[model samples]
Target: MSTLKILFVLYPGVTHLDFTGPHQVLSRAPGSETIVASLGGQDIEAEGLTFTNLADLSKVDRCDVICIPGGFGTTAAMLDEAFMAQVRRLGADAKYVTSVCTGSLILAAAGFLKGKRAACHWAWRSLLEPFGAIVGEERVVRDGNTITGGGVTAGIDFGFVMLEELAGRDYAEAVQLGLEYAPDPPFHSGRPELARPEILAQVKARMASATDSRSEAALEASRRTEPA
Candidate 1:
């Protein structure tokens, strides 16, 4: 088989972990090349970290896999016509369409996830309704060629899942072993369901502004597109 190209669609304000978690794993895939691109090949600042010298989104022509990582900038990225245009075009031809965190929203906005069982950050999962996405609560959800991961850390899981699909279980496990992919969190507060009620409340309160704005943006983007 020819070498597989896995391309990451990046934008400003991306959660650093969301992109790197998967990149770190997928980059290890045998016979695969991973690339990162952004608008005009400009630098991107994600959570204060800067990524430079990226491929220009418009200039990227093809990929076997395309991934969009989610972040605080997701709402703006969804609304950007040029960015979504690139997403739609690449996704149309890719063998696997995927996202991590709110990145699924970008896929939804591009009309790639309609009637598709996908995953996204739990806090914003409901936003998928506007784009006709069927929410999957699992850490990693795969519906045909579209695979999505929930929240931030799920990207690592997403990487391995897709890596196994492209390669095989043994190879994936081997990579996992090489990377020591074991998880033993000291805190049990990762998800809202697992967190104490007060803690969840505090997070929700802090996120209210972005959540509300993102909700409106999703509705608007969905309205602009014809349902698939």
Candidate 2:
């Protein structure tokens, strides 16, 4: 069987877990080759670590899958025509288009999610309507060849699902076992509805600035890409 080429779109300030969680699964899947690319070949910093030696966009011609991870920089990326153009170019012919968290916003900005049912971080789920997507509440939502995951931790589940699609359920389950993917969170407060009211308020308060910026950027992107 031919190897599957998986392209990961990287940028500054991307959340580490959003990228790494899925990567850990996809990289281990049989006959899969993972490639990381950015606008330039320079190093991009995430919340904690720096990703370096990334392939330049100009050099990556095509791939079987395209995965975009979300983070604080996703807002800035929505405003970057060059980056979005590259995304459009790369995603135009990919077999599967995928994203985690706010990365779906980037895909929507690039005009990829129009009329699709997709998922994103709960905090920003409603923002996708302007991009013509039916927002999904599930941790992992797949419509046609497009798959989107709901927040950072959802990437792992998204990854396993992708693996199953690529290989098989058995293969994916084996990989999950190898990774010891069982999760038992100490607190049942992962999402707003499940969290305490006070905790939800505090979380929203802390994310106010980022939410405002992402909202503004999404509006601008929608306007610029509107039917003309």
Candidate 3:
């Protein structure tokens, strides 16, 4: 069986869980090969954690799947033309183009998600409008070859679905079994609609600055990529 080559785009300020959660599952697939690619192949610091040995973007010629992760740094990436050029190069040929959380915003900025129904972290869902995407509420949204997950934690769920699509249900189930993938969160307030007023206010306040930056960057990217 041919190995499934998966390229994960890692950048500074990444939310580590967004990359690692899905990575843990996808890497374990029977014939999967995972490559984490970053600008200049340098070591990256992700939300206070360091990741080493990331491949340089130029080193990759092609990949079956391209996964992008999200974090505060996504705002900067959206504004980077050189970075988005590499993203467009890789995503143009990938069989499946996927993202976790605000990563969708990056994909949209790269022009890979125009007019697609995609999901993103709820706090930034409005940003998708500039990309012409139909925002979805589901944890994972798949529109043709583009698949996007909602928020950082949704990567795990997104991985399982991607595995099932690539390797079949039985294979994905076995991976789930091995990982003992089951959720029983003590808190019942994960989403804005579910969280108490005070809790939601605190979370929103914390993210306000980052969200504003992302909005500005996403809008600019949308304008740049619009059909003339």
Candidate 4:
């Protein structure tokens, strides 16, 4: 079997689990290779965790699959014209393109989500429309060659789904069983509707801050021609 080369785009402040969770699973697939790509040549810090540099974005030609993770860094990445252009270019050559959480926003910014259904962290779902995507509420959404996951943890489910698509249902099920994929949250507050009023309020406040920051970055990106 030919090896599947996978490229993961990472930046400062990225959510480690968003990429790592999926990478661990996908890399376990038979004949799969994974590389972490960054803007320049330097280590990246993710929520106080540092990841060694793997490759520069400029050196990548094509990948079998590409994954982008989300966090505060995604807000800046979405606004970076050069980054967006590179995403667009790479996506065109990739067999599959995936995003977790608000990383969908980066794909949207790159014009990859147009007229496609995609999933993103619920807090940022509304913004998907601006990029011409049909925002889906599912934990994982597959639209043609684009696969998106909701929130950070949903990347796990997304990986399994992609595995089933790439490998086989039986293979995916075996992996899931090996990983003990059964879930049973002690609390029923996983969704917004199940959250307490106070908790909901706090979440809303945090989202408001993120929205403001993204809006500012979007404005700046509109004014600038390319990323620095």
Could you say which candidate leads in lDDT?
1
Model 2, backbone clash pairs (residues 3+ apart or across chains), number:
0
* Candidate 3: tens digits of C-alpha lDDT, residues 1-228: 677899999887789999999999899766889999998898989877899988999779899999999988888988888888999999999999999999999999988887899989999989988998899999999999999899999999999999999889999999999999998899989999999999999999998877777888888999989889
lDDT of 4: 0.83
List RMSD in Å for every model shown. Answer: 1.2, 0.9, 1.0, 2.8
Every model's TM-score: 0.98, 0.98, 0.97, 0.92
Q: What is the lDDT of residue 73 in candidate 4?
A: 89
Q: In model 2, which range of ten residues has the least summed lDDT?
A: 40-49
TM-score of 1: 0.98
Ranking by lDDT: 1, 2, 3, 4
lDDT of 1 by residue, 121-190 (tens): 9999999988889999999999999999999999999999988998899999999999999998999999
Candidate 1: misplaced stretches above 4 Å?
none
- Location of the lowest summed lDDT over 10 successive residues in candidate 3: 207-216
Tens digits of per-residue lDDT, candidate 2, 113-174, equal: 99999999999999899999899999999999999999999999999999999999999999
- How high is the lDDT of residue 176 in model 2? 90
Candidate 2: stretches off by over 4 Å: none
Model 3: pairs clashing at backbone N, Cα or C within 3 Å? none
